[model samples]
Every structure is written in C-alpha cells, then in structure tokens.
Target: MTDSYRRQIDKLHDDVRRGRLSRRDFMIRSAAIVGAGALPVLPFGARAEEPASGGFMKLGLHNASQNDSLDPGTWSTSWTGASFNGGVFNNLVEILPDGSVAGDLAESWELDSGAKIWRFKLRPGVVFHNGKSLVAEDVRQSLLHHMKPDSTSGARAIVQQIETINADGPETVVITLTEGNADLAYLLSDYHLSIYPALDGGGIDMESGVGTGAFLLESFEPGIATRLKRNPNYHKNGKPYLDEVEFINIPDATARLNALLTGEVDFIQDLDIRNVSLVERSGDFAIVRTPSLRHFTFDMDTRVAPFDNPDVRLALKYALDRQDVIDKVFLGEGAIGNDNPVASIQKYHRDLPAREFSIAKAKDHLAKAGVDTLQIDLSVAENAFAGAIEAATLYQEHAAQAGININVVREAADGYWENVWRKKPFCAVDYFGRATVDWLFATSYVTGAPWNSGWSNAEFDALHKAARAETDEEKRGADYGKMQEILRDDGNVITVAFVSWRDAVSDRVGFGEVGGLMPLDNMRLCERWWLKS
Candidate 1:
C-alpha cells in the first residue's frame, strides 16, 4: 500500500517537472489519490489545510517596492508586512479563531486586577535567526524604543497609553499603563508588535534579519522580488519546513491572474472580483475566500470650502448608493457600510441610520445650499485595488446626475502615497486591519487623527480618550457607541462598501484548511503545504 502511494506521489511530481501536468491536471490527479487511498495519507479530513514540508513556494503580490525594513514596529505597507510574515518575525500574542488572544512569543500573560499593569512570562530557548538567544530584555528594549514619542513609530500611536515596559527578569516582562486599557491584548497581537533583537547602536534594526521568526531574508530586490530561506534556528518544532519563498511583485491585476493560471506562482492573494469567476471555473485551481477586515472610504476635507458645510456633506452621503456600488463594482462580494468605524465583529456595533438612496433628497440639499455646478477634486491610486478606478468613474457619473462635477486626477504608483492619498483634498483610500474601536477611532476619526475627515468635535475626542482608559467592557462599548453616533449622524464622509479579499491557489499544494480575518504569521500556511506526488 505504501509503495503504491509513493509511486502515485512520485508520478505527480514527475509530471510537474516535465511541464506535462498543468495545475488543473495536478488537481484531478490529487482528487483520485484522495479516493484511492482507504487509509488517508493525512489524518486531517478533506478540508485543505496548511502543509509542513521542504519545498519552494512562489507567491504573487500586488506590487513590490523599496520596503527594506522588516522591523515590524515601523513597517506599514501590506507587501512589506507579508514579506515579514515569511518566518522572520513573531509577536507577543497571536489571534485565535474566537477573537481571543493566544500566546506566541510570550508563553503566558495576564492583566492586573485594576487592568493598569500587564505581565508577560516569556518562552525560553527561542533563538533568533542569527542564533542569538531571545530574552525579556530584548522585548523591553524594542517596545520602549517605540514608546518614545520622538521615535515616531506607527505603533506609538496605538500604544499611547503605555506608561512603561520593563524587564522584570531574564524571562519576564512587565508593562505599566497610564490608563486602564482593555485592548492591550489586541494591540499586542498586532503584526507591528513582532519583536526585534536587543539594540547595540542605540536602536534595533532588521537590516541583517535577526528575528526569531520561521524564515530568514536571503535576498531582496525592491519592486522586483524578495527571496527568503528557512531559518534553521527556528524555535517552533517541526515548522518552517519550506525551503524557500519568493514573492514576485506583479502590479497589474490581469498579469497577476495570468501568472497564477499559468502555474508560475503557487498562490495569489487580493484577487479582484472581475477575475474571480475565471479562476474559480478553472478546475485546476482551488479558490479560498477569507472574510476581509479591510474597508476603503473617501475622506473629505471638512476644514476646506464646500465640505465645511454640514449640509453639503450630508447631501453627498445621500447621493451615494452603497448597495448599488457593492453590486455593480464589487459584484456581490461586499457588505453595506455606514460612516462608522465599528465593524460587525466589534461588540459595540450599533445600528445607525442606514444610508437612504434618494437622488431627490440629494438634489434638495444641493438646492438648499444653492449649489448649481459643484466641482471637487477626487484623487485615487491606480495600484491600490482592482476596481477602484472604475468605482470612482461610476461615482463621478452618479454625482454628475445630481449636479456635482468631480475633477478626477489619477496618481501614479510611486507618488500616490506621498503626494495624493493623504494630502489630496478628496481622496479614496483603504484602511486595512482588525482594529479595536480605540485604535480605529483614534487613527481616522478622532479630532487630530492623521486621516481625520476634516471634522472635529471636542466631546468626541474626550470620549475617545476616555474609552481607552475605561478598561470595563460595557463602559468602553458605550464610549465607542457615542463615537459612532457622532460620526454617523454628523460626520463629513460617506461610507462606501466593505470589500472581501480572495486568494486563489493551485490544487497541487496540499492543505485542507483556509484562513479567517485574523491573519496568521504564515497567513495561508505556506510552510505546511507540500507538492502532491
């Protein structure tokens, strides 16, 4: 029986090497193998799960750029984060299926009775990629470096309430909070919390790649490809079996789809809706749909003319048909969204006024405001998403009917992030993450938030700050509810639609499981996947 199974596996790889087996053919053979073997090769059932093995996996990313820094505290772009995930990083906590935190770098952690202090017991014997032993002092130094306001780490904004982080012993770390923070666990689980080695030159840097993660950076070429090799000193047992991973940046969506279909890449993520059916219908490919926590919205400059008028903002909100946008643009792959930060997973998500689609109401507001021909500059990036350009075009057509003219200015990939997205008067951009209410509210909705949609209320700001300090679930929820109410009823922006991310994998890869919103380090388990024989 063993000999027969081995022969089948060998034959599969032989076909792959000879280029005689397309992904579709490989999948067909895989299905036969599954049925022919009465005793399963894997104890795990039919569901595709991550595989553990030694093989090279080629991954396709939307675009690659000069993101050399793998120090998670500072990296922000999705491509950079994905590159870090290959096995070179580990955070204190990891997200579980039920939305609770599980130990990753830290063996155990607990909050004080007052919720003002947190203690973490570190796992011993974990070694960095360079073979250095990981200790509690390394964790403290990395976190404290971010705590300094001058450090300017994005994580500083999220961990604002943390008063101090100290090494209690060689294997213990303690953190003091200026306020009772309930979402500390969530923040720790954030990818940005992935630890860095103890500093030597006044700070820690990953230029040489010295993390306790599963993969080590072997070579990198900005905007072209990044190559990573398995870490031999990895702490996790029986993990990181993949010999190598190469991420090739294919900016064009059509090109990316073509590459995946041609078996040039093993996995492709962020598949747009237009090509989803094409990939799905191809029998050789296995489509995995993960619930997306990412959402894109337009931010208005309320501090400037036109948008400064609450009536103008309210009228614009009524003009947008969220349902129509979702159906026509997203093609039934999205959910309706309001101008609120709280998503469905959030415990405090409250039902506010659903955006009513009424051109008449929009016209009335325009007339009351005495706007005849309204011209607004709308900025968007061509590289961000698949249908963003078309979505903006559709909105322009719809808004024109209501007597609003949008001067659409498209930006290039290289300049959009700095010159257009945030700096532009009216811009469409995506905010991706499973954020706690405080983090999301403070980042985009609060008075001085970097992405604040040109509207600010002192009361809202106070409540946002207090919510982080509350620590009590009920009270925190109430604070977030108030924040949501202010944004929904009186905010300056329109909530568009929540998008779903699609990943298409070839069936030759063996894994019976998929992923949820809570992204794992090896998001799709490339380490656990094996080429079918």
Candidate 2:
C-alpha cells in the first residue's frame, strides 16, 4: 500500500477507536481505497506507521494586519489565532482530537472537596522558548495577567470569576472560584489562556514572543509573514514533525487561491465558495472541507439609535432571507443560523423554528416601532468573512422590499476591525465559535465582553451566570437553551448563516488521523500535519 493511503487508514482506525467514525462509513472508505486481494483485511488498533518528518510548509491565511500583536489577549483574527495558538504557545489544558479535555502544560488536576477549588499538577522539566522552567507560579501569573483591572482583553470577562489563584507548592497550582463551574477545565483551554513565563515585575512580558509550544518564533512581521523552527526541547515526544513552517498573510481570496495553485503556499485557511468547482477541475490541489462551529452575522450597536429599539432589531431579523443569502453568498455550503450564537452541534442548541422572511412582518414591526421608513448604514468588508460583501448586498436588496433603505457602506479590509466593526452602528462580522455555550455567550453576549456585544441586556447576563454556576448538565443545558431563546428574539445580533470551513491544500500535506475540533484541524495544523514527500 502507498504511504499516503496508509496514513488515511491510520486516521480512520483511530476514529473507529474513538467512536467518532461509524462502522458503515469506515467500511465504505476502506472498500473504496483497497481491494480485498491486495492485503484488504485491515486489522484494528494498528497505528505502527510513523510519519516521515522534515520539510517546510507555507500557509496562506486571511484577516491579519500590522496591528497583530503577540499578546494572547488581542488575537481577534484567524491569522493571529492560528499563529499564536497553533504555533508558539500552549494552554494549561487542551481539547483532544476526540473532543475530550487533556493536559498540555498541566499533567493532571483534581477538584477540592467543595468542588469550588481546583488544583493542577504542572509538568516539570518543561522549558519556555526563553529557557525559563515551567513552574506553578508562571501558570498562576499568566492567568492573572488577563484579569488585571485595567485590562481590555476579550478574556477579561472570562477570568473575572476567579476569586484567587496561588501556587500551593513548587509544582502545584490551585484556583479558588467564587462559585462552582462544571466547565472550568474546558475554560482553561481557552486560546487566550496560553501559558507564558512571568516577568520579575509581577506581570508577563507582552512585547516578547516566548512560549513552550512545539515551534519557536523565528520572526514575526505583523500583516506580512511569520517564520518558525522546531523546538528541539519540546515536551511531546514526536510531535511538530515539520522542521520549519511559514504563515503568510494573503487577504485577497483570489490571490490566496492562485498562490496555493502555483505552489507558493501549501495550504490556505479559506476557499472562496465560488472557486470550489474550479479548484476541483484543476486537480493540482486538494480541498479539505469540514463542518465547523463558525457563523456569520450582521451585528448592530444596540446602545445606538434605531437598533436600541427591540422592534427595529426584530424588523431587521425578519427582513433577512437566510436561504437566499446561503445560495447567493455562501453558494449553499452552509446551514441556516438562528439569531443566537449557539451552533446546532452545541449541547443546549434548541431546534428553534427558522424565522420566516416576510416583508409584511418586517414592515409591521417597523410600524410598531413608530418608524415609517428607516435608512441605516450597513457597513461591510471582505475581512468580515468570506462572501461578506455579497451577503450585505443581498441583505440590502431584501430590505428594500420592506421599505427599509440599507445604505451599503464598503470599508477597507486593512482596518475594518478597529475602525468599522464595533465602532460603526452596524456591520458584518464572523465568529470562529467557542468550544462551549458558556464561553460563546461570555465572549459576545455578556454585558461588558470586550468583543462589542453593544447591548447591555440584564436578563441574558443573569441567565448566563446562573447556567455557568449550575452543576447538573441537564439543568445547565435548560438554562442555556433559555438564554439562546432570549438572544434570538431580543438581542442586537442577526445570525445569517453558519459556514463550513473549506481549505485548499497541497496534496503533500497529510493529517493522518485527527478529530478537527477547531478550524484548521483545531488550529494545530503546524503541529500535527506532515509533508508526505
């Protein structure tokens, strides 16, 4: 058998072990690959094939700029998200390929008798890229770095519930929470909690790029490209097989697609839905498409005029034709989205009926709001997400039927996040999605979350907190369902579609066996992938 087919089978075998792959699907894939005569009998639990390491892989990605910082708290774009989390960093814990929590910097953990206090045992002998030994104090300090009173990090609202954090010994760190959080361990895997060596002044050095990940930062030029070399002293025995990697920022999707086709880049994060067939016809590159938690939205500043009125928000929601947007913009590669952040795969995501696209209802809601005809600025940019400009244009046309005049304001791609996103009264945006419902709400829906929630809805905040504190999974799920319902009808956000991640990759790269939790193979492609040649 060819080495490439073996790698694919290896991943399939692991999935079968993890209960993620169905037996029927496995049999079909297996039957299609190799015939019964040429060693067709596949044995279970056979992963003896080790990957061939050493080659450089260039990546083309989107949504990066000169404002990119090494600070974990400031990673808003996928360019930075994949670079920081996938490259030069490690969390205390991580979600495994099979969707279970596992230790990264931490070896193990246990809850105190009250379950409100948790203790994590650190892995000794691990050294940062700066050569500082990983210690309990460093973990505690790294976490506390996000909770500083004057901090503006998106993670601030997440770590605020921690009452105290202290090192119990040279190797043990303890966290005391004001209340019990059943999902605390999952929270630690938040990409913002990347562990870093502490400075002598009781703070982390945000300016320096130092971490304990599988790769060391060779060079980082924001909005341009970053280079890395394998860390010889990395803790994982045989990981980060690639000897060198480069992440190049290519904002324009056509240029990015051409780059991959011409072999300038081995992979790119997003593939324009329009080009899926063209790339397939070329056959020079392979396409990797996976269902994801990512979603697109048209957000409003609920604190501002027109949007502040719930009826206006409802009218806009009714004005949206999700199916039409999916067909025109997404090219029918996405599922419909409710007005909530929770994906259908999430635990508490209820099967709420889709909101009908009715121009009459939209006009009725506008009349109810005491507004005869409304003209609003609807800002859009390519950086918002793939197909954002086209989506906004479609929305503009749809709103016209309801007597709403949506002035489509096209913005520059470079500074949209800083200048247009939350700064504008309304804009188009996207979310990579959080691992859990609590984390999702905390990032966008919470009252003061740094990611521009715009609305200060008291009931949603209370329900979110109560759900987080509940220990029973069933009870917590119920509370989270209620929170989603409130946001759907009464929040300032209108989720238009949930998109699938479609990546165009060179056939040289291989992901042998893995559960892709986040985009780009849980944002660890650099660490887990290898060049077949």
Candidate 3:
C-alpha cells in the first residue's frame, strides 16, 4: 500500500484504540483503504451486546412553533425534523453514523449519461405505515412535490436541476438532471426530501404523516408535543427497539435540562454550556459532544439600505470580535468562523484566514460607503439558537467601538422563525449545515434561493455551477475554494462561530456510535437509540 494509505490506517487504528472512534467506524474506514475483500484481520475490540428492546424514550427539544406542519415542504426546525422526518419518514438516501452516504429507501443506485442520469433500485418489501407497499411512483411523486413552480419547500433550490423523474418500473426510478452533478445522492439525503406515500389522485399525501419509516406517528400537537410508536413492519430487521417515543417542546434551555435531570425526559439537545459542570457533578447523565458543522450567523439583507453597500457589509464584518463570541457566549465550545458556511470537516473546505476585528478598518469601510457613522437594528431571540441573545448583546458592545450603533431588538421566542428570521432586515440565524458544499451554498447562498441573504454575485454563481458539474476532484476543489473566497470577502453573512453539537443523554439509553452531522445523532436518535432499562 502507498504511504498515504498506510498513514490513514494508522490513524484509524489509534482512534479506535483510544476509544475515540467506534469499531464500526474503524472497519468502515479501513475497508475503504485496503478494499473490503482485502482488509486484514485485526482485533476489533469486544463484541457489541445486542440492543435491549421495548421501552419508551422521551426527548426534550428546544424550539417548536404552532406553525409547524406535517408537510415536508414547510418543515424547517429540528422540532419537525426529529419528530417527523427522522422518526416517521425515510429519505431515498441516508447519512450513516460514520458520515458515509448509503441508500435508505433505494436499495442501490447507479450514474449514467455523464453522471447526469441516475437510476435507483427500490428496496424490496418496504411498505408504508398504512400498509401500502413502496413503489417507484411513490418516490417520483414525493420528490416532485418540491419541484413545482410555487412550491415553497426549503429544498427547492437544490432540486431545481432535475430535468425529469420517470419511474422505469415498479421497483426502479430514473432521474435526469439538467446538468451532471456527482453529489446528487448526497443532496437526496436532505431531511426535507423524506419520501411519502403517493395519493391516488396526484402528488404525495403529506398531511397524514404516513411513511415507510421505523416509527408510525401516533399523535402530533404541532409545537407542543409529538408521539410515535414503533413500526412493526419496518424494513430494517431487529431495529427501532423503542416501543414508543415522545418529543416535548421545551424552548427554555433551563427547563429542557431540568426535564432531563428530573427523569421527565431521557435526553435533551442544545445543552446550556454554563451547566456543563453541574451535569458532570450530577453523574446521572453523560454528555455527548460531537464536532459539527452547525454555525451561527448575523444575516444582513443586501437589498436593504446601509447593508446594500458592500463597504458597509465589510465594515460590519470587521466590527465584531468572533473570538469573544466563542469564548463568552459559547463558553469556548466552538471555533471562530471566517464568514464562510463550509466547515473545516467537510470536503473541499478552504482554510481561509480568520477575519480580524479592527475598528480602524471598520471606520475606513464605513467612510468609503459615504457614512461617518452607521446605526442598524438587529433582530434576535432565544429561539434562534442557544446563547443567541447573549451573542447579539456582545456583538452590540463590539460594534460600538467601530462607530456602528447596533440596536439589538429582542423578539418573542414563540414565532421567531416565522416572523423575524428572513422577514427582518438583519437577524440572528443558525444552520445545522448540510452534508455537502453544493447543498449548503445552494440552499442559502445561491441567487434567488429561498433562504439566501438577499446577496447575489454572478462570479460566485458561475463557480458554484461549474463545480457541481465538474467530476474532476482537483478542478472541483479549486472551484469550491474560489467560491469560499468570494463569500469570505464579499458575503452578507457575518459568521460568528461553529459550535459543537452538545447533548445530554440519560444513562438508561444505549447506543453504539453517534453522528456529528446534526444534533441528536443526526436527528435519528429515536430510531437508532435503544432504552437500556
């Protein structure tokens, strides 16, 4: 083997030896290096115990709105993603615990026509919660739900490249893209792309919440609570050990943590960093800190005044102390951001130099924008994310030094996402981060994208399109790097920090490995985790 491959194997071995990596992860990485059939025999630690079955699991999650809906198109927050998408529905592809992509509903897939056409073979014997067998028509209708002209699905930007989707047979689907995209499979793993049963008339029936997932929705109370039962007919064998699952909406961090400590809930997400020591002292729970792509941002609407000028945007970017936000607000649980959405852990990530805080530079940029001093209102609420209000307060203090008066407007937590987020000129926003670079940029950065920050650049758009279609790794990396530079230098987002997915779990829960891609084990804890007691 080459030296590079040998070094990778050594690292995986060390990670597994130190208990930093699971045995399954070690095997997965090793097989990728030495080929599955050529993998050498090695001691893989102790044999894992079979998962204990038949117990109820309750989770206290942060932030839920009465506006939440069963329709996947309208689903945005983790509240709906965990309860509905992760538990009650399945996507065509899934991001495994090891961060590898694998077929979920589709048993296998192949690319053709210069990677522009994809053929997916559906998994056999899969049936929906209502006893309807999964068919190719179901996948087609479910995907087409987001492609309609007036469809307001969050996934619209990513799926717009599809030229056509045709059911080749009862068990096969053929999708043709307007252009070649090698990362199309990864995009399909998006939570908003959950497959639902097709209606006899047309389109998929999204209101009923009937899906071919590991769980069946029993009750849904919008922002209050959601209840689900194990799917007896689930395709995966010896899975979804929990007999029932409940998700309670607890917007307050203290209340969410209290629910876990009081044994009212088995787990809680977005744990308050200030209480890390208290949880450790209690010893009744264990903290699961997974390195994640989740990042916090201050979004400026480029369409609005003050922010309409690029120099003003640059002045705002230079006014904040990102390190201070990471240290004070996040309690040093995150890395400083460089105004780029792509995380260091992702492929084709560019190591851009950190944007230093400089009052002089900020003043210079403001002067270039024909302003001696600037004042702007920043909308924020506790519902944006943990420590959002505190971060905005610190930012308010930092910008004052640069002659930038920031008015931090505290909005209500109940309907923050629906009311303040994109509607406000400037606001605090957080993204869980998509699986791929293209998915991330397309969802929130591309021109005319629904979640875009009202900033558009023809150069950046060109690079994005070229990179998505390029199959050459070197060429793709270069294109992605240019896009990152463009965003870092001229983007409307002031990225604060990329935080870790810190969650607390009760000792009663059992699981092998956790996924870092999203909170609560990629939001699949309901199905992958089992109750030990």
- Tens-digit lDDT track of model 2 for 1-533: 47667677767754543234543466677776666324343333112346768899899988878888888887777777667877898988988655578889899999974568999999888999888899988888899989988887768767987899999887999999888776788888877888888888797867778899989999999878999899999999998899999999888999999899889999987889888888878656777665557889999998899999999999999999989998888776777787877876566777788898999999999999999899999998987889899999999999999989999998988877777878999999988888788888888888888785578878888888888878777988888888888989998889998765678888677675343447776777788888875
Question: Which window of 10 residues has the lowest lDDT sum in candidate 2?
Answer: 39-48
Q: Which residue pairs show backbone clashes in model 3?
A: none
lDDT of 3 at 310: 93
- Model 3: per-residue Cα lDDT over 413-468, one tens digit each: 88888898888999999889988999999999999886986899999999998998
Error of 3 at 189 (Å): 0.7
In TM-score terms, which candidate is top?
3
Identify the runs in model 1 with alpha carbons over 4 angstroms from their true place. Answer: 1-50, 71-74, 367-370, 450-455, 518-533
Candidate that beats the other on lDDT, 1 or 3, i.e. the better one: 3
lDDT of 1 by residue, 73-132 (tens): 555556666667435677777665334567888999888857789999998898887778
Best by lDDT: 3
User: Which residue runs of candidate 3 sit more than 4 Å off their true CA positions?
Assistant: 1-49
After superposition, which runs of candidate 2 have C-alpha atoms over 4 Å from their true positions?
Answer: 1-50, 514-516
TM-score of each: 0.85, 0.91, 0.92
Model 1: what TM-score? 0.85
CA lDDT of each prediction against the hidden true structure: 0.69, 0.82, 0.86
Model 3 lowest lDDT segment of ten: 39-48
